[model samples]
Target: MTTEVKPSPRERLLEAAATLTYRDGVGIGVEALCKAAGVSKRSMYQLFESKDELLAASLKERSAAFVASLLPPADDGRSARERILHVFEQVQSQAGAPEFRGCRYLAVQIELKDQTHPASRVAHQIKANLTAFFRSEAEQGGASDPDLLARQLILVFDGASARAGIQADDLTGLIAPTVAALLDAADMR
Candidate 1:
């Protein structure tokens, strides 16, 4: 016999928060969040100190999911450069999903705007972590200027995500070859 333990209240709330944020963006009141999570306001307050804390926790969860999905493969039989470029294909596939709504971190920044906001801080940190991944990959691929290449790659990624989310366009076909050309220009491959 096996016992199935249900998700904790915090897990349920974070899951609900992530889904609602993807569907409706962030900054909804605690009452609304409680309703969405199917937890009571008392439960939410017991789990998180405030709405900002809940939102920040939810953003962190989403960021981890993004990193796990978008990180280049280590031994997937593709060159590091191709693996790096594979991020676009991964993101494009994710964007095409029914519940996609661009990046949730970007959504928080757009909605909050204040640099001091907790959610804004979380968003900035998530972006910095992504940039770091690009930098590391660029270095491993033998780029002469790994830092610069990483910055450029982040720009391309940002643009592709924006276009994919806003214009509903498919960029997978162009991304890999374009990235390969950049690697070639950098004497990487």
Candidate 2:
């Protein structure tokens, strides 16, 4: 017989924060988070310095899976243009999910509204890393202006994510062509 070990209190709390904050907003209070995690407020504090720290840690913990969900594997042998489009294709698929709520990092930044907040900083770094990925891919694709192309890609990504998140746009015929145009304009192969 195999015994399934339950997650520790700390892991449960992190899971709860990530799920609740994404579904609801960062406005979710500690009480609700503890209830979801089945942990006590005292235990929550003992595991984390504060709610902000918990939020930050949760974001940090999920960063790897988040990036993997978007980014193509490193050196997959696809052209730069193909790699870039892979990201948007992933976004469009994710948006089709019923639980999609735009980008979590973007949501956190919008809700916190304080760049210096611990969670805000973590969110910022995650986005910056995404932009950096675009830049690197742009350079590899031989874009006319890698920086410009990267910025344009991130803008489209965030815009598409936000719009689809709110159900304002299905992105059915949108993201792919828009990204292709940008890549074409940048003269990327």
Candidate 3:
């Protein structure tokens, strides 16, 4: 015999927020979030003090998952430049997916830009984490200035994502060569 355990209210709610907030927008009401999660408002309140808290939690969870997916494993047997440029290919593939709706971190920031929101803080931390990833890769690639190289590579990664959201087409062919040049220039290749 086997037993199936349901996901906790917090986990369920975060899953709902991940789908709804990204698909519809963060303007989605608390009621909608609860309904989608198949959870009671009480459950939501029990885990998170408020809807904003849930929003921040959702963003944090989603961004961490996403950045992990974007970069390949360190032992994937590829050079740093190959691994780095692979990110552009990911951006295009994700954007071209039927449900693509821009970067969730950027989406939340746009929704909460004016206010001093915790979601905004989480988004900034996600970007910092990404920059740190790039810095480590640049070091492996043997860049003379790994920090600056990481910053530039991060900008390329960001711009390609923004373009992907708007263009919603495979921009990898256009972006990858430039990144290759960047890697070569920095001795990352």
Q: How many clashes in each structure?
A: 0, 0, 0
Name the candidate, 1 or 3, with the larger lDDT value.
3
Candidate 2 wrongly placed segments (more than 4 Å): none
lDDT of 3 by residue, 1-189 (tens): 999999888899999988998888878999999998999998889999988899889888887578877888767999887788777678767877867766777777877874478878888789888889889989988898899999998888777776676664457477878787887788776
Candidate 2 vs. true structure, TM-score:
0.98
> Considering only N, C-alpha and C atoms within 3 Å, which residue pairs clash in candidate 2?
none
Q: Give the TM-score of candidate 3.
A: 0.88
Question: Cα RMSD to native, each candidate?
Answer: 2.0, 0.8, 2.1
Task: List model 2 lDDT by residue over 1-189, tens digit each.
Answer: 999999999999999999999999999999999999999999999999999999999999999999999999999999999999999999999999999999999999999999999999999999999999999999998999999999999999999999998899999999999999999999999
Best by TM-score: 2
**Residue-level lDDT for 88 in candidate 3:** 68
Q: Each model's C-alpha lDDT?
A: 0.79, 0.97, 0.82
Residue-level lDDT of model 1, residues 149-184, one tens digit each, is: 888877777767767667566665866777777778
**Could you estimate the TM-score for every candidate?**
0.88, 0.98, 0.88
